[model samples]
Target: MPNHLVPIAFELPHITLRGLTNNLTHKPLIVALHGWLDNAASFIPLLTEVTDYHIIALDWAGHGLSDHRPPGTDYQQFDYIDDLHQLLTEQKWENVILMGHSMGGILSSIYAATFPEMVRAVVSIDAMGPITTESSVAENLRTGVLSRHQRRAKRSIASPVPLTQLIDKRQQHTELSGELVELLIKRATRPVIVEAGDGGTQVVWRTDSRLRNASLIRLTEQQAQELMTELSCPMQIIIADDGLLAKRGLWQQREQWFGSAEIVHLTGGHHLHMYNTEQIWAPIAAFLHNIST
Candidate 1:
């Protein structure tokens, strides 16, 4: 039988998060988080490949079907940690197994470090930890603040386009298969009326465009190292052979921060978890199994 994914929404004090889950009755929750501009749908392929545990894949705030932050407020990297903490507390989930991809992987590492007691294990794909800023401290802060100020007054409604065009555009950039592109388009867009030119209706992305902007603050290399040192839970860092980390010579440094964590190199792109599910699942499953035993 095909796995059934139940749509769920968590109403929090600050924002509402939309997610999809399978087997809520199972213990030791596995939370899957997606990359920037992507949504919970990104995990569908992976979820379908693994059915041993209950898993919930969340659309981060301002992405997918989740609620966006109030106007004039930009998305800060640390805010995601707070949001996840609140969600876990509200749901009374302890000893969580975080499975995060790309940007989500970075957030997962931070969360595991920030609240080591609550996490049982972390499975990070295509990213080791938070990205560090190389710019001078003063310049980094200045640019972040300036960008927010400049973008605050420039908010505008996005123009709608045909669904096929949206999928085609994403395919061009990500090189994702048509099947995966269609799945993302379905979760990330909403139908709307377009009164200009053709005067027909179409779909537009549901994610807050502000998310495309850089964060207001970023962790420095020293801070990231500190965070990595604080991680007590077993971690699994999976690097794709052709992904960004491998290309930039950063994957070689994974052992420095995650000394005890298991590192595996596979053949695929950054989104291997979505595109090459089987290749990625074995290591993650083995890690989870070992921790549980």
Candidate 2:
């Protein structure tokens, strides 16, 4: 029987993070991470095929039911690594595998590099490493600060919208099919009382607006390469034929950074694991088999 997803939450010092798990604790654990704007439900498809491992897919802070950052604080790229560290340390989990998609995949690589002993392997889907920049520090800083200010100035109460409309809007930004988009959007939104006394509620996004702001800083290309060199665990990178890292020769260039890594190319869009679970899971299953032996 396919495992059922159980709702779970982690209480950290500053915020509470929520997630869904397959609840198979007897098996080895795989803590899954979703991409930008997506929540834990993004892994629902994979949970059906990945019954061999105990999987917990988290809703990054401000993305799903997780608490947004404290007042006056904006979201930063590197702070996610710290959040993951706190959750793992509190749970006392060790030597586990990390499965991440897109932004999540980037974080997995950096986290594994930072603390290689905690991660037994890493499964990165459609992402090889962190995006790097060649722009001058002054220029990057200025752009990021301006972007945050613009977002803050534009913030306002969003009008309640229909569920179908939310899915339509999200699909416009990605190649994911409507069904796939709906799965994620459902978890990322909540119902709010839109009428003063009519007992009527309408849906509104729960994701923090600060997430759309430009990153305050990014690793330079040299800095990104240096961090990759610290990674020593076996890594499996599943590249989608039409995904962001689909450009030929990209993965090959970064191949040398890992102690042991292999690339598997599958046919699909960026969120292939959701719509193409069978094809995506085969290589991942094989990868895990190879690791166990």
Candidate 3:
């Protein structure tokens, strides 16, 4: 199918949200949020299946073409919730259908709970709510402060490299197919002029280096439970059979947190949505259809 997606930028006071949208005139706006270190292009596969509703896939604050956070500021998980709130308010959106992957999925669930009346439904892929920390409060706070300072003080600009090398490097870490890797490279990189041999230019990942820093803090088990219990919309969570949730024994506990949620298991790794798009799309489409009618 021909690509019908349009690149869009949502300007905010602090940072701009970069994303792609399709069929903007449609109702019940569907917003897709990508996983950590990923960009809006992660949702391109769904465009072929989810044609009935308007869709917007965002690149969060520091990913893709979006602006990075101000210097000296750490990337906090809650900051995403604030950004989403601003985006929805600016667009005058209500009862939105949110679909998120990995970190995005966690954020979407938190947002739905925080403002239950604003979300119609939620589709979480390979994650559910926030991951709670078992560390003591004092220890957690101390570690967070030290880590943030160390990361900020040592931050440096990323050197540009050939696109082919970038793809090869990423492939070593994940089982993503060549096609998907190429797609991500296209969305997450830009050409840069080099002062080398022939003064040639190369493409580099456009993500902010600060995004690699560890989260400043994490929700406690009690906090995560509270957020999950507060969710008022229909929810669907898809976990890959070999995914992180399964490995860490979190699926059962996470599933119990939601009052109204259905859980399904698919066959793939953490990024099942990118590699097994068709399988992932079926459940998502069904959830959206059921909620809309």
Candidate 4:
């Protein structure tokens, strides 16, 4: 039988935004975060193996079921971290294990560093620290809403992006099982406003793309080190063998930043572990088992 996570908008009474929370109370508390352009459901495949922990996965704003940004809003890196900060500040979770992937990984790194006392451990999948060196940064900012006042026009953020089309796209990159695909389809998207020439409204993705703006919050080597300087718990960094971010001096920089942290490189692309949990779950499970004990 599928374990159904309770459906409730984990909302702070004073806050307009909310997160989807699941309580695995019998297990250790774990906060799992998905990658960029993905949602809470991304962790579904690994959910079975991680029965020891109560995992709280999140749908970051504008990705899954969360709220979209105001027109011309920059999906700034800092904004993502701030939302997490809000969650941590309002909740009473203490020393919970933290796991995040891609952009989520970077956000987790920042959160653990800033609030060392609250984290028990951290698992960063294929990323280390903040992303300030991406070439796309300047390009996105030029056309993106965060910095530029003008609405940068694009021909097609979602060209032919029917749900069918997105599934096809995901298929081309990785081999996914039917059940996994269904779960991803459920959590990864919402209907978007599309001008399909009839002038009527059509639903599509906001864009399955990352930000192009040059990140204002650049990280130097020292700042990276400072992020992990105060952590008193075990640290685990999971790097993907094929992920470009892992190859681009990130592992080295991340190692320097997170002094004394355990590093493990696994096979797959950036979302490899999430897509194919059968193969990738072993190391992750072993790590969690070793640490939780």
Error in Å for residue 276 of model 1: 1.3
Candidate 1: give the clashing pairs: none
Better of 1 and 3 by lDDT: 1
Show how many residue pairs clash in every candidate, following the order shown. Answer: 0, 0, 0, 6
lDDT-best of 1 and 2: 2
How far residue 244's Cα lies from its native spot in candidate 2, in Å, is 0.7
Candidate 3 vs 4: which has more lDDT: 3
Off by over 4 Å in 4: 1-3, 13-22, 71-73, 134-161, 173-182, 191-203, 206-214, 230-232
- Candidate 1 local lDDT, 1-293, one digit each (tens): 13588788999988999988886566558999999889999998888887688899999999888999987677889989999999999988899899999999999999999999989999999999889888887888888887776777797778878877788788998857988988888788898865555534479888887786766577788888988899999999999998889988887875688889999999998888888888899888988999889
Candidate 3, 1-293: lDDT as tens digits: 23688888999978899898886665568889999989988888776566678888999998988888987786789999999999998988988989999999999999998988889888999898897898988888888887778877886777778777777788888878877887787778888865565544578778877787766678899988987888888999999998989988888876668757888889999888876878888888887888768
Clashes of 3: 0
- Tell me the whole-model lDDT of each prediction, alpha carbons only: 0.86, 0.88, 0.84, 0.66
> Order the candidates by TM-score, highest first — what do you get?
1, 2, 3, 4
Best by lDDT: 2
Alpha-carbon runs more than 4 Å astray in model 1? 1-3, 193-201
Question: How far out, in Å, is residue 18 in model 2?
Answer: 0.4
157 Cα displacement, candidate 4 (Å): 11
Write model 4 residue lDDT over 135-243, tens digit each, in one string: 3545544544443433254433554345655675677765565556546665655555556565433346543333444344455555556655756567778877888
Q: Could you give me the TM-score of model 3 versus the true structure?
A: 0.92
Position 276, candidate 4: lDDT: 60
For every model shown, what is its TM-score relative to the native structure? 0.94, 0.93, 0.92, 0.77
Candidate 2, pairs of clashing residues: none
Judging by TM-score, tell me the better candidate of 3 and 4: 3
lDDT of 1 at 53: 82
